[model samples]
Target: MSDDDATGDTATKPGDDRGATYASFVAIGDSFTEGLSDLAPDGTFRGWADLVAEHLAALTPGFRYANLAIRGKVLDQVLEEQVPSAVAMGPALISLCAGNNDLLRPNGDPDALAKRLAKGIRELRATGAEVLLFTGVDPRDSPVIRHARGRFATYYLHIRSLADLYGCRLVDLWSMQGLRDWRAWNPDRLHLNETGHRLVAAKVLTALDVPDAGEWHKTWPLPTAPTASRTENARWAREHLLPWLGRRLRGTSSGDGLPPKRPNLTEWP
Candidate 1:
């Protein structure tokens, strides 16, 4: 399918009567925003942010976009490294998704993370851009991260509160049942797969009141077989889990030397 078809049929329509023409967009956060597991043919991640940008660009001429996100980045890194650049660009739309990495850590502090996130939102809003916030989906199907569901819930609630307080748009991933399915995830069972990213792009557009043809909340087909077996889980643990744990132990990150794929707010191709 074409990018327009995958994103939404109405995505190419001109801005609605509200005059919500997004001339530029900037996405800031971690691997989720960075598009991990949604690999392009060139081996780069073409995540929801990119898809959203493309959708908007098709509708608005001279629509520029930037994505300042890296994998395995905690909220602090995002606030410190990305927020400044995003503010400088001064895009009409900005989407921020962070704190999930921090929440995954032991003894994660939801309150503290929320405070930091709120500060960033406030700063972004000061720039007069429509800031978009996200609540991560529940990873109930993932044996490894499911344990942190309580923490995730706490953080998600806090995010909702911030969005309400700051008048920021919220993309409530937590309520998306489709994301809970293993089929939407990659081999690592962490990041969303290509289909998952497409759905997210559709949802984000919908949340922004951007015209789109695709439905983000559509139900997936029922599973024909049982979920992952013990043996399959074990293999996953060995391949994806152990390495992540090791990184935590050594205070290393998967995005150690990586740079944002689209750092500048250039016109979308």
Candidate 2:
């Protein structure tokens, strides 16, 4: 978006809560925002978006939050299903994180993904709400996903560009040094573990200029370091990678027929 394109300041920087008294928040994306591996005691996803919402609720009375993200969704799906609804609600703030599922594909194009994302941001901003954008984590360390590092890096650049152009708040997860640890990931190595999700929540809150986002940025130690044993790799391939491939080959999605965890903007619990 150009300077003449956007109407409001939307969001500025680290602590630029300058008139940013966001009373309502809507998160639209994919599994990451849906909370994935970060499960509540009830075995449901409660990822970073929820944490941010909870914190914001305490700060503002009647603060409402909605997360319309479903697992296995790509950028197109999110824009089609969730973006329209979020735009209709006209929340004070909207955070969007997606496109990784597309980039993971053999035919994924970073430039195309960025263009699609930029279009969404433009539409969301037109609703007079702030947009919070996220960059994908570095994939250099993961053997399975390492080959996509170049693509992800390119996508990150586009993400930053769009955020700057649109004056949207940015939660640059690729800059999170703590994510380099394997313990921050689930056994599948494709999603964030509880620790990783908590850290991401902190980053998002910080971007929104929320105080006391927590000490999740610190490099906390884990009981067990990540390993590269063949047996372990085999287990992951069998249980995670193979299944994911099978689903793709069968033209199915893990999130098929699933509903948004939080379909409406209600007071955060």
Candidate 3:
């Protein structure tokens, strides 16, 4: 697939609400799954996974949800730490969205990452849990990392293929036209913002056949051109991008000792 649009949308058909109902769900991945930029009023992360869980809880009473995602976790960390624990929960549904952190690394190999992801997904599928997968956002529009667009595309294609092989429901984030807007992201220009999270949650519910998923997919107005101006670029480098590189150089991560936000499946209050 040469373009981002070419890969996804093959796994789960949109608007095909199969009336599926899951009693519980577990989301395992990196910061995206952990809801970094999408913060709650109380300053807690409440990203797309939480929103999807909310919709699922609405359908099934006493629906339990667990989020084992941590910030800055590479695929290996996710597989080694989060995946095993999520599998143990035995949730009826599992959403895996790791590998972005790995992709950001200079040595990141999409093919090798895909192989690891497939193993994790296969393990999740073996438990009779309906696995949810995702393709990353298209980086073509982001000036900061647009040069690596091909790398992200490679990962997206692999994710699409893996989803098909494992029969996992997929939320094709790269195909969502609404997220092309810069307003969908926070200042870091990496993680999705609250609006982006809302859109992603809608996509996830739609993939899972949640009844009210349609209400969240409204068309969004484009930003005044999300192009990175010189000033904006400088600010992003100082505030977000440079620090990320420093962490990589120092062999450290933001989630070095932090625990999962929702480590256990419990009724979401």
Candidate 4:
């Protein structure tokens, strides 16, 4: 997965949205983009992309979404395939979440990841979508991911620079939050669980200046100055249960006092 080499995660069906009258949103990246986790099943963009979409539906009047996320996709693959799609859609907003796959895929070359990511950024911006670059937490904290933290940190900062260069908004979850916060991740310790996604989405919505962003903020309050361990499972439970209850009680998925039955793709790799 060199910067020049292209590789992608498992193949997936493009998202389905034929009747949406809302502003189009396109997401590009790897498992994080695809929402790979204990909570998200295969072929779903369960991460912040979905959360953002849900929030936007409430505020934007009528926003649609197109997730170009492919699991295992390196920066190069996204630059080639996903970027073009974003250009075609001319989405109102576009989010780019890459680099993790470059770290995970065999032969993943970190040295050039920044360059490839920047290339993708340039293309996404060309589509006129207000590009949103999401800087997530370091995966190395999990113990299973092997790259050195220093290297990933370097790449992360460089990606931030690219975002600034492109004048795109950045949601630096990594900088704003700590990885030691267990509530930040699901049980799999890889992709973000529902709680993490909500937090990330709220941050992005605020950063992007999206309307009514506060509605997407954390519904569950942290245990008065919560410790990392205490908040971990509690956050997980909130992520799983809150949305379900809200949706069920409301009886509508999107409007008129009903939240869409946005089911979590709670499957595995």
> Highest lDDT: which candidate?
1
Q: Per-residue lDDT for 1-269 in model 1, tens only? A: 12221222222222234436699999999999999999888887898999899889989999999999999999999999999999999999999999999988987888778877777877888887888899988877667778888888988888877776666778999888888888888989888999999889988988888876268985878889766988888898999989999999999999999989989989988
Q: How much is 255 displaced in model 4, in angstroms?
A: 33
Total residue pair clashes for candidate 4: 13
Full-model lDDT, candidate 1? 0.85
Q: Model 1 TM-score?
A: 0.91
lDDT at 216 for candidate 3? 50
Note the Cα lDDT for every prediction shown.
0.85, 0.85, 0.83, 0.61
lDDT by residue for model 3 (166-252), tens: 578888988787888777889888888999899888888888877878555457654566567888889889998889889989999
- What tens digits encode model 2's per-residue C-alpha lDDT throughout 1-269? 34333333454332345535579999999999998889888888888888888888888899999999999998899999999999999999999999999988888898888878877888888887889999988889887779989988988888887888777888888888898877788998988988898899888877777777776575756547457688899998999999999988997899999999999888777
Which regions of candidate 3 deviate over 4 angstroms? 1-17, 215-218, 222-227
lDDT of 1 at 124: 86
* Candidate 2 total steric clashes: 0
Candidate 3 scores a C-alpha RMSD against the true structure in Å of 4.7
Q: Which stretches of candidate 2 lie over 4 Å from their true place?
A: 1-16, 222-226
lDDT-wise, the better of 3 and 4 is 3
Q: Estimate each model's TM-score.
A: 0.91, 0.91, 0.90, 0.66
How close to the true structure is residue 45 of candidate 2, measured as C-alpha lDDT?
Answer: 87
| Residue 81 displacement (Å), model 2 | 0.9
Off by over 4 Å in 1: 1-19
